[model samples]
Target chain A: MASLKNIVGGELKGYTELLQDARQEALNRMIDQAKQLGANAVVNVRFSTSSVAQGAAELYVYGTAVRLG
Target chain B: MFDSISIVIFGVLFIVGYLAGTINEKRHYKSIKKREEKLLSLPAISMKRLESSDGITKSELVSESVVVSIDYFKRALAILKVLIGGSVGPYESLIDRARREAVLRMKESAPGAAIIINVRVETSTIGNAANSKGAVGSVEALAYGTAVWK
Candidate 1:
């Protein structure tokens, strides 16, 4: 991958988009779970990412579900 | 022995990487400053909770993540720094940009919210080169918080 074109490094746009999409999907799932619990808000949200396999990564998101009056 | 042609090619690539990386970083910083000013009204705080939760009508989770790649020039600088045993200055701006961009996007996602609390920012390196040597890699920054509106 050290070709001449790769010499001048820049933003990996495709990888960026892919990670963003994966994160969004994880967040959406968390939100859905919170909704199922009849919670209107989630606080103290946190995100974690790990490379589970070569060329594969996992995004884990969690938070506290709460009802704001 | 190192071929003269290969050395010349390497030198050219280093120059190109430096020029392009500098320009890209400058443009990104400019954009970041502009957006930060535009979103100045909404504050994202790291406090887990507000002093008074009163009058908070609604709240929801908001987050944004970004992956930024490093240029060959900066990577070379980082390698050099590793040998010298000092701070890697070239990568600082890269991380800063990624973090700021993530936070900005998080704020953008919750436009109507009055404030964001319990904000958290996490970073990690991702890409084929992340674990390998002699290759460029990307950093991922994730920002999250709870946006509340009164």
Candidate 2:
């Protein structure tokens, strides 16, 4: 048996109305990457956001892809 | 001479900021309370399992994010707090409201779901730096969870 580890990220900026879009994009991207690695589910998810510049911020979400039964 | 003038100017500005900030904070808190009452049942709980997954018809993710600006008075107080090594009370309430509002918005997004599980809120301060007077800081709160629709 073997275990693997990797990290991925996404970014977006706009009105508060569209903020969720960015968050989902980041999360979905992480899920997609995990699925590519053939993981069952993601665990220990951690979400982070930071300012890229004035009036704009970027959301970064990550998690450990795992196989659970 | 120049220092005294600058001091007076800042003092007056501080007074104005304090007055406006107090009023704004009060109004915001009032609104938060009202909405919180409406959302009392839709808790953004951290528990991974909200209810029995047995009868769950479907599952999906729900997320909400909000950004709020810190008033000048709070910013000034935060500066003083940095120097005195104390907590910035105003910023704390701002963060509190942001998180609640984010959760409330999440509930709105998942209208079919009654409760969300594994909920978490993340915050970020949008500014030039953690401690900077050059720009007004804005706090962004993001809340997400797994919603089971039955």
Candidate 3:
């Protein structure tokens, strides 16, 4: 797969899919936490991605949970 | 002398990359335009708060990220650009597409939102080629905002 990417030199669809999945997972987890706190909404959202290993990355997401009256 | 077979291989790769890359970019841009038109009514603003929060009963955080890769042909152009020390045109479009796509996805995730406030977009390079020489790298764009609706 790596060799093919070097030759084709186009969008890495597989890697993109992987990252998207990871991001969605992180977002869902954040939402679940907010739900546990009885929050109807979350604001001031933020996200950051960092390479935790040679070939792995970590997607971190956070926001302020709030209940709208 | 450099091997002729390798030169031919390189040429083939370059042509293939160029053809495939152009098609991919055109299709992506077309989809982006259509989606942008469809979502035009939803306003996304960078301001921290709105003048009035009247009737805003719910709010939620929405975010999206996308990773776009460069084709061999464009990477070659960028490498030559490095020597001449000027802006890399190919990379500019790549980042543009990534940002727009990310924002679009963020908006899509909040279908019921009235408006998205405090929107932010950020970008970075990732993958094996990010810090190395002669390999292609991918650009990641993250867009986030708070979606509020009545």
Tell me the TM-score of model 2: 0.74
C-alpha local distance difference test of each model: 0.81, 0.70, 0.81
Give the CA lDDT, 0 to 100, for residue A25 in model 3: 94
Please state the error at residue A68 of candidate 3 in Å: 9.0
Clashing pairs in 2: none
Interface RMSD of each: 2.9, 15.3, 2.7
Best by TM-score: 1
Query: Local error of candidate 2 at A62, Å?
Result: 2.7
Query: Which parts of model 1 are misplaced by more than 4 Å?
Result: A1-10, A28-43, A64-69, B128-134
TM-score-superior candidate, 1 or 2:
1
Cα deviation of A66 in candidate 1 (Å)? 7.1
Candidate 1 chain B worst ten-residue window by lDDT:
B127-136
Candidate 1 on B64-86: residue-level lDDT in tens? 77778777677778878878987
Model 1, C-alpha of A57: deviation from truth (Å): 1.7
In candidate 3, which residue ranges exceed 4 Å CA deviation?
Answer: A1-11, A24-43, A63-69, B130-136
Model 1 clashing residue pairs (backbone): none
